[model samples]
Target: MNQILPLELPNGISLEIKREDLLHPFISGNKFRKLKYNLLQAKSEGLETVLTFGGAYSNHISAVAYAGKEQGFKTIGVIRGDELGDKITENPTLKFAQDCGMQFEFVSREAYRLKTEPDFIAKLKDKFGSFYLVPEGGTNEYAIKGCEEILTDKDANFDFVCCAVGTGGTISGIINSALPHQKVLGFPALKGDFLKDEIRKFATNQNWELVTDYHFGGYGKVNEELVQFINQFYQQTQIPLDPIYTGKMVFGVIDLIQKNWFLDNAKILMIHTGGLQGIQGMNTILKSKNKTLIEVQ
Candidate 1:
């Protein structure tokens, strides 16, 4: 866990971040937690292949590829945007996945939206044969089970447990394991209250809620201000944060602190769910748009 030093609030609020991002160099953070049992289950089921879905620069796509390689399972990534099929070299995430031996099945955005539909899944099964399926963002019962282990008994001392919400898996797991007195605050990477419903499906505890004010537009969207904040934050703490998830959560948490959202002397624990690998891909987009790039190490 890394203690945040720059956030000097008036109410004596202290923030400690769990560096789940440091859990692995590639499959880090919630991805690491989410994939643990799913991979084990695949092995136990005698599955020789793992298949999942994601977008162009999806951390899930990249992590699943690496995890599959490490576990000796053939992996296939059903990537959204068929146009991306011809642009693999330009995308860091896809290129890394390819190097890790993950095959890609690029589909239209419309088709990708039907990923949960039986017909679409049947088509994939027909093409890939029998494979262990992991949903986009790696959220499932096993994923949630793995995530529930994120918070340890030692974390019971904190009054608030905060994390970036994506696909609702990580926070759901945190919500399930959090101490009764610890309120789990989720800062969503995407724009919507729909996440609350999704989170409720897995997180049985009522101690968690979403703070939805800092998306910077929506998923995979960013502006100059957010870019500057992420870069400056890296400079200040020597910690690299991915703009899509952790950066937004940290920004919101500090903003909330400035607004005196928590009581005096509250201890907040932020889960640094890693998406750092996506920075290179995001920087590529930022550079083309003539925007400030994420300062990656």
Candidate 2:
């Protein structure tokens, strides 16, 4: 559902958020869209196990764990940071995945860097039996195919579509389905130019551009200001945005509006690709450092 934000903006600019977060309790937002067909294909191939990769607090990991279990497939998560293996109980995301019966293979950060290598994957297959592989962030062709369904006819009226970019999958799908006159703006959570090439590999349209200024340092890095903004936004809108993606994108959109970057009377639709599951983990970190926490109800 598209929810109109009650913010008063200059230039008659209108804002609405596509609450993809409400799609499911666990497999919500783009995660649901990205995994829809991939899981089906796995089942079609008579696969009984699904293996994927992520970090300690990855939303993809959490979603895949619950979704795989719900779909009657055993799940394995190849996690970065070998140290996290022993810290599972203290980490909400890892603990939740474990509770969902997702087995984990913790690898060193250096070894995790070889995740895309064929030799590394061959070693994994040698260690574990044959299983369906869902790449990190779930951005394979099948995943993108699923993400393309995010925008429907009801969204056609918007002048611009906005979303947070991670692995470039969600934005690529939005770019594919967007109208010719509508522009798609992607706010990448990480600081890098490589995402453009990643998006190009899947996106067939030229209507989208990346707004790279709002990462607030890099992936998984947040400050008090961002925490405050997220808290305030939720208090006002009653919409909880995960700090990693949607929060940053919404901050960027509102900042751009204040700067008068968009034309007058433009209507913007933002995709709330859910990562709310990570909030508990993030809040745990914030508390350790005595930083402002993201408010949740």
RMSD values for the candidates in order, in angstroms, are: 1.0, 0.6
Candidate 1: where is the Cα deviation over 4 Å?
4-6
Candidate 1 lDDT at 28 equals 81
278 Cα displacement, candidate 2 (Å): 0.9
lDDT of 1 at 176: 94
Which residue pairs in model 2 clash with each other? none
The sequence of per-residue lDDT tens digits that candidate 1 reaches over residues 102-158 is 999999998999999999989989988999999999999999999999999778889
Worst 10 residues of 1 by lDDT: 1-10
